[model samples]
Target: MKMNTKGILFVYTMPLVLLHESYGFFVPGYPTKHISVSPQGKLLSTRSIPSTTTKPSLYSPSTSTSSLALKSSASSDDVQSITATNKLDSILSKLTSAFPFFVLGSAILGLMKPSSLQWTNQGTLISWMLASVMCATGLTLEKKDFTNVLAKDFAAVPAGVLCQFLIMPLTAWAIGRTFLLPLPDYGPSLFLGIALVGCSPGGTASNLVSLIAKADVALSVLLTSCSTILAAGVTPLLVKVLVGNAIHVSGWTLCEATARVILLPVLMGMIVNAKLPNLASKVSRFTPFASVVLVSLICGGVVSQNSSMFLSSKALLPLIVGSVMMLHCVGFAMGYFVPKVGLKFSEVTSRTISIETGMQNSALAVVLARSMGASPVASLPGALSATVHSCLGSILAGYWHSKNKKGKEESSESNKKDFTDRPEDDYPELLI
Candidate 1:
């Protein structure tokens, strides 16, 4: 038994001592009995190793050097991994923060390429995508949602409509006359964009903005659908009335083309959505991607169409300023005052109105420009507005999202306190 115990101690302690001692990791009082210094220099209590262990009469201080070398090697790998992970996280956050801006920039860059603007097979593809997006937008509707909106009997509903149709159109006209500085070749495009907004129904993105602001979602959905249906007729009429001469548009011609391109497709989508709800869902799922592709193609086409104009730095200021001012004023004003007139809307709904008014169906405007025989310069306002409104609108939506979250938290807390104060014995009575 004694011999076996000594053999076990020797087996365990000899390897540890040799491995650790070369690096000066010492197990104190160890020469007298079984003890071991681990690679990290901690004294480990081991039942497997016996007591009264053998030791060299002359022990060296450098016995644990190999262990130290191993630990040093492993630490370097851990450091490298942490550094790589930090860099990856930074890159991801930056990309996420800048995604909206990047999309806007890409649209602007596409405008410079003029080749991207030419009407070709690709233009038809964009048209089809626009059709699909309209269909997806239509899929979310039910007849009841509209009826519910009608039921509200709130003045804000009609007020919102009036602001969209009347107030905004006037605002556009005023902006174009005052700021854009009339030019025969390009001034008409600026006016056309404003007219497009004056005529366009609320866009699909308004529903998303309304959701973020915690506004009346059903009302927003109702208004958007109805307004879109109205837009088919209204857009052409308003464009003819306001900027018809600017583009030399024949009212009937513009109306017919508008009906074919914008109204017919939207009405068709709505009909399809009503009859084939399942197909609507499957297609609507791709609306985001579809919208992106369509916008890209349009912007690209516009760039290609106006490549020479784009190459001139002198024309850059008018294009940028005119587009920005038109979108900014129309969107910001309608958003601010429309809710305040006669009917009271929560801050959220107010924000939604602003976004909805500002973000027109620029795609429709671009298509209309093509039909009008207007230069690509005329479509520039619409293309640039598409980019600006999306970025600004997203920023505004994010602000409202934060506001809604705070309101929800407060409401939840109040509910919790209300429950806590109720009598323990009166739970059933409270339910009754």
Candidate 2:
């Protein structure tokens, strides 16, 4: 019985092997004549088999088995390429997953020893680091990706952008006025910092958060890119209009700085990607990881620099913390629900917009705050805001990730049940 079963298996598989070999010669542009070694160690020329014939029998030994071998070799190369791409994608995903932890660790270390990372406090250093972050963002983008997302849903981008500029800055102003402005000494500087946080563009970090949250990552990137570029014009204007009395700010200077640090770097990266995609891809593989490190350093530097102020203002720390947290929470809630209620967008798009709107480019805000000659006390909010938003975003990401996993499992189970209910003969081609 075992010998009979073995014979049956060989009978079934041998036909498939022979059919595969015969089909290889019929491939378009393949040479009609190829040499193969038969079981008898004789050279078999496959020219006897007609290439135009639709059906070739396995019994025909005239097949060019060499062509089959060549096809198999090509398939192996394709599999290798696919494996490498998957490995690269996995590495990038891991980096994104651990982003919040890196930010937190750096902040803690900076607070513990303010002098260690003090070199990062220079205005020039901060500006260049920010430009690098923007450049990394640009490397990930393509012209078609943006156009595709925008063309698919025009309302989403515009609405999100409007919310980003409108909601965050106004929230910041209200929070500052209610909480910080009433204080005696640090009121003006603190208000200025908080206002700057509100006025700034959607952060690059939001893109990573969106990815983790299983939200619309493409939309997140587009929103961040658009807001960052427009920030060159809009951020300074908002500052001038809203907080001009508290702190003297030159809109023109701020605009120039925004252009220099944010716009130029992003454009340069886009140009590189267009011209040399292969090079850009290689560089971008590392950018996500690099951006996390850069952000951590920027946040850590702020904490280190302001450690003294933070200690002295322990009485007001809770208020400051509460105000920043409230500002972000409001931004997140409004960003999510506004479109769901007003524009009637899907939950995913709304989530993406919420993240983009809630998370401000606090690093850029910190740079602007210091460069514009704001006091260290004023700059503390941006630093604290950075840490606060990262934690909140990470928590939100964890929730979304688990929810998405559960949803996928349920969908898979339903699909399995459907497959089981179907008759086998209904998919005759699949049976082969």
Best candidate, TM-score-wise? 2
Q: At residue 179, what lDDT does model 1 achieve?
A: 58
* Model 2 per-residue lDDT at 282: 72
After TM-score superposition, the amount by which residue 212's alpha carbon in candidate 1 deviates from its true location, in angstroms, is 2.2
Cα deviation at 189, candidate 1, in Å, is: 3.9
List model 1 lDDT by residue over 197-306, tens digit each. 55665665556545544566777776677677777778778877877665576667667666765567767777877898777655554454445555655655565556
Stretch of 10 with least lDDT, candidate 1 = 57-66
- lDDT of each residue in 1-432, candidate 2, tens digit only: 122445434533443354355332211111123334334333332233334543322111111211122222246776666556555554454544455556666666666667766899874887788889988878777888789888988789999999999999999998888888889988989998999999997687787678667788778888988898899899999988888877688888788888888889989999998998878867776787788778778888888888776677677778888999999999999999898888899989999998998898988888888778778777778878887887787677667666676675566557555655655444222100
> Can you give the lDDT of residue 207 in candidate 2?
77
Stretches off by above 4 angstroms in model 2 are 1-89, 414-432
Per-candidate clashes come to: 21, 0
RMSD of each: 23.4, 17.6
Instruction: Flag regions of model 1 displaced more than 4 Å.
Output: 1-105, 112-125, 415-432
For each candidate in turn, the TM-score is 0.67, 0.77
